[model samples]
Target: MINENVSIALVHYPAMDKEGKLIVTSFTTMDLHDIARPARAYEVRSFYIVQPIDAQRLVIKRQIDYWLSEEGRAANPTRYEIVQLVRLKYTLEEVVEDIERERGKKPILVGTDARKYHKTIGYAELKREIEDREREFLIVFGTGYGLPPDLMRTFEYILEPVYGAGDWNHLSVRNAVAIILDRLFSKNRC
Candidate 1:
């Protein structure tokens, strides 16, 4: 079980801006310390190229190993268990395969009105259901433009599309995460 003291984290290779430049030399702590020195906005932002799978695997291995360390293990044993870990690599479609294989049931994928369904799924009700039926629930998502059509069809419900900011979508995943974390902490009276 996870402790109240620790939290889960995920890292991604954020796509580069329209500019061809990937890496900037100004991410050093000293650089941020001297913001008055006048640096381009991009200079403060570090960038990475599309990483290779082997490189990604190496990164995951190193990360999991670090998590398995004494302090880390206490933080999240399930995430970094020394015992067998059921990690399977597959494209978005394989989410169905893995769910059926392990749970003998397919996951409910939702699309369309993402916001409406997200809110409709009462968090408290979900908690009660999970408490009674099972403690674990798996949610999978598609990346890179549109979601997989086959998987989208399998969703039990479609979420309403959300509109925010301006004509174009402006919110980043980090922003969404911060908002969610804030809600969680608020709920826990933290």
Candidate 2:
């Protein structure tokens, strides 16, 4: 788990609405705790919440502060410890920049969507690629309607969709994050 080559970014801006129009979604404090917990459990180097709105950032900062406060820590020290991995960023570019600053090179940005993209890679293959390439990666997940093609196109890798027997495959952002992280890092994969 010491690879230190993997990070996750939950993108709120430049995301699409139900009507397919690009918009910036409001930040949700729930997603912060949910995603950060698993990201920490899986030994992810960092978890970035990418939101552009100033007010939203302030709210997120307050929530983060509360989580780190002595009272908050006393309420649930384990939770506070995991949440300490969360970092707030204004945009995906900033996430990349921070990753580069820490790792000494830009991460291989990867996007995740509910639908398969032309050059998408499977979970198993992606696991191998990460190990073989020995490079840092920033796995990006979008909000509504999933990540648009243009935004997805910027990623060096795209993960294949996770589906079940039925046609329905839409999952909440945090749920998808947990599933994707398990697929990428779970040791039981065979």
lDDT (Cα, 0-100) at 99 in candidate 2:
95
For residues 3-63, could you state the per-residue lDDT of candidate 2 as single tens digits? 4789999999899988889999888778988999889878889999999999999999998
Best by TM-score: 2
In lDDT terms, how accurate is model 2?
0.88
Candidate 1 error regions (>4 Å)? 1-52, 74-88, 112-138, 144-154, 162-168, 177-190
Residue-by-residue lDDT tens digits, candidate 1, 33-147: 1221111111111111122245554654455456657776778664344212323232334444554565565544433322344333443443344345433243222222323
> What C-alpha RMSD separates each model from the true structure?
12.0, 1.3
